[model samples]
Target: MEQIFKWLLTVSGGVIAFLFGAWTPMLNILVALMVIDYLSGMAAASMNGELKSRVGLMGIARKVFIFAMVAVSHLVDLLLIENKIEVGYLAMSVVITAYCLNEVLSIVENAGKMGVYVPETLTKAIAVLRSKPQKEEEKPVAPSTLEVPAVVAPNPPIVTAEVKKEEKEEIK
Candidate 1:
């Protein structure tokens, strides 16, 4: 048990070091938003009966890809400008703008799952975000038919399957 605990701690420490080693406030904020968005999305997906590990992992991959894109954009900016301030601002602008939009969208999506209707401003924002890339049109579609399982609490942010069979089906 002690060995297991030590191993877990070492792994956790390594992960933290790797992820935050390049930490800027902007990167920190983005990471926080990413985590919140992932969790909230998982909750919403569960509520809609669309939760799958494969889908969740794909979401994570996409999120990471956004950061990679931002990095590439920064590289381009660096090559173009002699002013470090200009390059920093350009990179920060690209990354922060994308993360801010993503966080707001996640909040609205989670609220929608909780049965809270979004305000028009938020809806418009979401629409704008959706218009970003042509691939945005492939956004995940919520199922038209979903039921609150008897075992799941009415107030749960995520819906839970009542039976093992349903859980198995969901995993598949």
Candidate 2:
């Protein structure tokens, strides 16, 4: 039984290393940044009273996709090496660097949400990422849709101020 456990562990480690490629400094930084970005995001959401299980689950799924991308990049790198493509492992480096930049941006945004004054350049980058070009016909909204709009009564009462005394008496 102990030997079986040891075999399983060895296989698992081999599979992981194969999928992740060589653990370079760039990969190490990417992983650390990813973790920090995720935790900072959670903290930001919690502070804003926006934390929800579904969103958290979605975040986990996104992180899984990130690793999947890394694996795909690594596979491409392997192909390049095996075929003598002369690309020199650019795929993995590109993937890792892209994700690291993304994580850094997210961490900055999270810090901003948590009331930390980030640098102007970083805030501008966040704003650029956040902004969407609105359509020409789009309208601005009242910030909160939670406030109920006014509803009319089923039957409104008749106004009597303009009615003459004779009319009032007749109605009575």
lDDT of 1 by residue, 1-172 (tens): 9999999999988764443334568777777888888888898888889899999999989888877766665556656665544544475467667776778687787877867788888778777877756554555657775565668566756555567678888899
Please, what are the lDDT tens digits per residue for candidate 2 over residues 83-171?
99989879988998988988988999999999999989878878898799777995777778557779989899887776677787898
lDDT of 2 at 142: 72
| Top model number, TM-score | 2
Per-model lDDT: 0.73, 0.89
Off by over 4 Å in 2: 129-172
lDDT of 2: 0.89
lDDT: worst 10-residue window of model 2: 138-147
